[model samples]
Target: MASTSAPARHVPGFSAPAVGFEEPFAMLEACHERVQRTLALLDRLREHVRQQGADESARQAARDVLRYFDVAAPLHHEDEELHVFPLLLAQAAPEMRTLVQRLQQDHVDMVADWAAARVPLQALAQGEIEGFSESAEALFDRFAARYASHIHHEERQAYPAALHLLEPALLGRMGQEMAHRRGAPER
Candidate 1:
């Protein structure tokens, strides 16, 4: 008899969670989890409109997506910019500099893409529109792809490099600042 296993699923945001803000890297990972979850929700929204039209579920999904990207995503980016990037820029090897620059540019592009998606998404959330434009859908795809790639790069290279570059004191400070930024109690 041949052994069989369950088919692998590609759920984007269901990875292991970050312990808390006390561990800054863990918190960043947690933020990425939420980003994945929210992006998945956006995909569901598209499907919902296709299958069910602009119903209550779609509205709620839109609302959830807006809340996350508007509030959490910016903070996540800020956390990286404030605590992670500077250290890397100053300390990482020469080869990493270009990668860091590209990541920074990604941040800029993400912000712009979010703004473009937001207009249509906000309307959808408010029940002002029953469907999204083709441009909005394309923007969402681009946004998701950019995030997926950005997260991949950070996890694969930048973050691990940061773990080595930053000292204990700096890591502590990063955790504290991250906690305070989120209004989470310092751990």
Candidate 2:
């Protein structure tokens, strides 16, 4: 029998029927919102796996996870690496280069975590994510753990560095660049 009880699901970070922008911070803030929503969905997916209901949900959450892994995550990384990091690296004290490397390492590590998840997640969406051998629960757990820590580290360490290092002029250029990247017309 199909369960009648609606599972208590976490709310997604975005809810309105529209998307809006308020200028420079909009792209960054939207990325933040995307990560939050995707994390919430990831948490729910983990919960479903814990209940051994991956088969039940058919990994419906995979769609959202895949979208995040492919789009939002990569764009944020690109913005940091190509735009923010280079600006910081150009003028940061020599002593701080190591911090930059460590932050970049965090991005690399998170990419690896996503790499590890892709095949199994793809398979899962194919109606048999693991062929009865792979532990779907284990897979989801590892992905969640790696990604959650990555986000926390950036929020705590990397973002502050960018904020500190970017000059007002560079920041304006960055705002324009990011806006262009997101398809906003010249302002």
Candidate 3:
């Protein structure tokens, strides 16, 4: 008798729909949603590796996480550094200024953390490893934790404060610059 079980289904990672650059703040917030989803995927990948030992699904998940952090994440940071941070630094109150400085440092730290985390992930994505080392897992944990805190701070405080400070004209200009840098079509 032939088997009747269905083949396994591969569910792709969740990604929020793209928001246009015309709404730059919304675009940034959308990026935050992507960040959270990618991080969740990373967590799932880690667990999958532990149980499944770098199967094709695990490898693909590693690739997805790497691609987002490598490409989209840096651009998101640049969007804030170039457009958002300057406005806050120039006009927001001293407390907000301190928060922005800390956020900037968070960006620096995240870059360093990603550099370390990328190594084992690269090996996994290339089918060179079955699972992460203790140190590598720790690196991943720290990286995710930092991003959680950083995103929370930005969403709760920095974004609202910056949005309040920006006039419509400046916001439009900021959006244009962001779109130009990413080669995104203007709407």
Candidate 4:
């Protein structure tokens, strides 16, 4: 007998349509929006696992979170490292230079934190939420907190500094490189 229950639908945290590649700054902002949504999904997954014990919804959420962080995040970080950070490192004022260095270190810390958080998420994806430990939840909390702070710093300090320093040509080149890195067709 077919189950009468309706198929589960994704509960997205927010809806921010992706912008065009030509608008590189806008694209970065859009990516940040997606990151926020994915992080929220991670938080929801924790609750779902706790309450529902790795049901289909929890499994799906784990997979979604894993896919985003594993795939999209690296590209986004590369976009910042390759396209955004260099300009600030080379040309920004002394105060901004210090900020850029801190931002660069934040990227490294984020990668480590994500590695720690991914273990339980991987288990959750495999319908093994029983294996989720308190340590994993603590790691995830730290990871999410670090990401929030990192995003704030980048949006407030690093991105604006890069925008101010990069002229139209450099910005175009950065966008093109970003698209190429993602295997996306350049517009």
Clashes of 4: 0
Model 4 lDDT tens row, 82-172 = 8888888899899988988888898899899998889888987886656468899889889888888989999998898889888899888
Model 3 lDDT tens row, 130-170: 89999999999999999999999999999999999899998
> Could you tell me which residue pairs clash in candidate 2?
123-129, 124-129
Separately for all candidates shown, the number of backbone clashes (residues 3 or more apart, or on different chains) is 0, 2, 0, 0
Lowest-lDDT window of 10 residues in candidate 2?
A: 1-10
* Model 4 residue 32 CA deviation in Å: 0.7
- Candidate 4: minimum summed lDDT over ten consecutive residues — where? 1-10
Clash pairs (backbone) in predicted model 4: none
Write down the lDDT that model 4 would get.
0.78
What Cα-based lDDT does every candidate model obtain?
A: 0.82, 0.61, 0.84, 0.78
Candidate 1, 1-187: lDDT as tens digits: 0111213322222234327555789878877877887899899899899789999889988887887788668878998999888888999998887899999999999999999999999999899999989999999999999999999999889999999988899898898897676655445
Cα lDDT over the full model 3: 0.84
TM-score of each: 0.89, 0.71, 0.89, 0.88
* Highest lDDT against the true fold, candidate: 3
Q: Which ranges in model 1 have alpha carbons more than 4 Å from their true place?
A: 1-18
Q: Model 2 over residues 1-92: C-alpha lDDT tens digits?
A: 00111133222232322433333444555566677677677667656665675574746776667756775577667777887567557767
